[model samples]
Target: MAERRHTDIAVIGAGPAGMAAALTLSEAGLRPVVFDMNATPGGQIYRQLAAPQVDATLMGQEYIAGRSLVDAFVTADIDYRPLSRVWWLDRDGEGYVLGVLQQGHSQQWHADRLILASGAMERGWPFPGWQLPGVMYAGAAQILLKQAALLPSAAPILAGSGPLLYLLAWQYLQAGRPPALVLDMAPASRYRTLMRHPVRAWHGRSYLLKGMRLIADLRRAGVAIRQGVSGLRASGSDALERIHYRHAGTWRSLPGTLLLTHFGVVPEPQLMRSLQLRQHWQHEQQCFVPDRDATLSAGTNLWIAGDGGGIGGARNAEREGHLAGFAAIASLGRQPTKRRSATTRRLLAARRRDLAARPLLDALFRVPEGWLAEQPPETLVCRCEAVTRGELDEAIAQGGSGPNQLKAFTRCGMGPCQGRQCGESVTRLLASRTRRSPDDIGYYHIRPPVHSITLGELAADDFDNTNN
Candidate 1:
């Protein structure tokens, strides 16, 4: 049998939510084990300092906040395991059986309760020549900037939708090399649609102000900020050289070494889904959300927090984490003080209100129609499988009604990444072609070993089916 460890609470993901939950749980007299795939505590939002001896400024305030939380956790009797990727989780009686791969070895951790705060990923929309070299996701560009302090290119074109585009553009301008051009997909009229909700409008004022500042900076920097880029293509034999875009009903091509595109973010629920946690199709958010109660509990002992629940940004994620921590404490038969319960209730209410804006935002900025229309036959849809959009279309046309059939035929979702990138897109395309809702089509079925593992690692593990 594999060696086993136990803890009062197990928090997966060392991002803001997981770190916050661990700190709070420790304060409440519980020893928590926190696992993260990265080498440090900060999640993607607050990525860890690149090197151990690197100065803290390299990571910025996001990571600094996580570091402070980690410091507090250290004093609270929490066991922090970095660079540990959890691949499999099974419910063991009242707790969970967590399979983690660390240092080329397999291990297990049993916990009285498990909190998932895995966070979100940048949603990718397929476009013409998007697979070309130097064409990267906007979030990837931000990661390069945040972790390496390196600009993607000397003259990059920023194109796509969502708040991250402006934020990244502002960062580039602050770094002295503003992007060559800014092509926004969301028309100005979208804001008028978003204005229907006064609360959302109020909550979004800061973003509007930031966008104004970014526009002003771009103007001063002599960078062109165009309203729309309907199409994006990179034409070059070897490296990226020129970008073709459709702006204001006119097609224009510009010379650029790199192109960064984003269509906002989507909940990363692969781990959660693999655990068989009930998920609801969030039509408003255009993503799948884990089914959770008011207290952030997904079921009996499984809890979730942050953008993994939905895309409400960092502040809302922190509030949800605090609620999950209190709830986990309560689940352990500990009675929280009246004051603490009251505070948690208030914060939960605030989070609910904040998330209410997601519907309008999702509807307004939903992936543009015909976004994938120009996808060439050879354009790779599933990077892991190297399956193209045309291949998927042909598979479906040949009576591949669901993801399973499509996978069997084209191997679209059968790769190392295991459909994280292409599953949703395939589901959407399949549903559209068959005249069915995405929910009816359902998400791809997940099996054991959600993440890829080496053969040696699997062979070494003692599979005790009786224990499970």
Candidate 2:
């Protein structure tokens, strides 16, 4: 049997949100345990900053700033667990139980109150030949660069829309490896729509200025950028050799060694779904986000912070973390001091500023209408099970009500990824075909064991597990 341990409070994920939350709680004289899958404290945004894989100067100032947060977290009196995965979460009476695997052994952690800081994942962007080798997400490439100092041997063709695409391109440019071409899927009309929000412009002036600078730098360095792009696909026998896209009402093909694509990101929802919290479709973000109150409370004895609550960036996530920490402290009957109350107000204001330009950003990078439905029949939707768009359509035609039924009709989400790779595509495809909103169509019915694990591992006792 797994060794069962108990804590007064627990924080999941060691990202910006998690670190801030733990720091706040620790300062209040509470010892909240933190669990992170990464070997280090900094999440993806500040990844590898604690132990630099590349020169710190190459990562830019935004990354360099996170070192302070990681340093503070490392020194804080907290039970920090690295290289740990919480695969299953269960409600146990008044508290909760987390099935965690660490260092090849399983242990159970019981907590009275929990703060879920699980971050976001890149949106699923499926296209013809996307499964080929050398075709990967732009975020994955950035991770490799941060973790291993790896870069494409050849100039890559970066496609799709969102801040990450340009951010990665600029990072590569800074690293002395600019992409061969950039195919921006967002058209001119999106920019025109973005102009409707001038108030947002003032609030998000810093981000806008930074983005403009990145674009200007890339162009000055002679990197090619084309907007109004669509109909992207990759082609090669065994690896990605060429990319095909449409622009200026004409189709063009280009040879490339690497193809990196991004379509923005959505909250990582596997754990939230297991909890069965109320969720609503955010039409702007184009993802179903869990419903939370002003204090970030999702339900009783629980709070959600960071991108997992929605797609707010790191700053917003950090603010939410502090708010959740305060709320959790209040729930534990700790009356807020005047300083804490003032800090809460400041955090709320900062969070509003952090999210002020979100609507404009969302409008500019929104997924195109009928985008999912426009995929060719042969295009794969579920890479895990080799399911195709044609198959999803066939399932819809067969009278399935939603994704759960479609999963039974075809094992699209039953693979090791557990629908993380294809859940959004399936929901959007269903809505597009049936003329229903995604909320009406609903998402897959997620269960426990959110992450894949071996039977032997699950059965092993925590007796010999030093992590316990």
Question: For model 2, how does the per-residue alpha-carbon lDDT over 264-317 read when each residue is reduced to its tens digit?
Answer: 999999999998887888998989899999899998889999999999998788
Predicted model with the maximum lDDT = 2
Model 2: which ten-residue window has the lowest total lDDT? Answer: 459-468
Tens digits of per-residue lDDT for model 1 on 241-271? Answer: 8888887778889788799998888888788
Error of 1 at 198 (Å): 3.8
Candidate 2 clashes between residue pairs 3 or more apart in a chain or in different chains: none
Candidate 1, which segments miss by more than 4 Å at Cα?
49-75, 459-468
Native-to-model Cα distance after best TM-score fit, residue 4 in candidate 1, in Å: 2.1
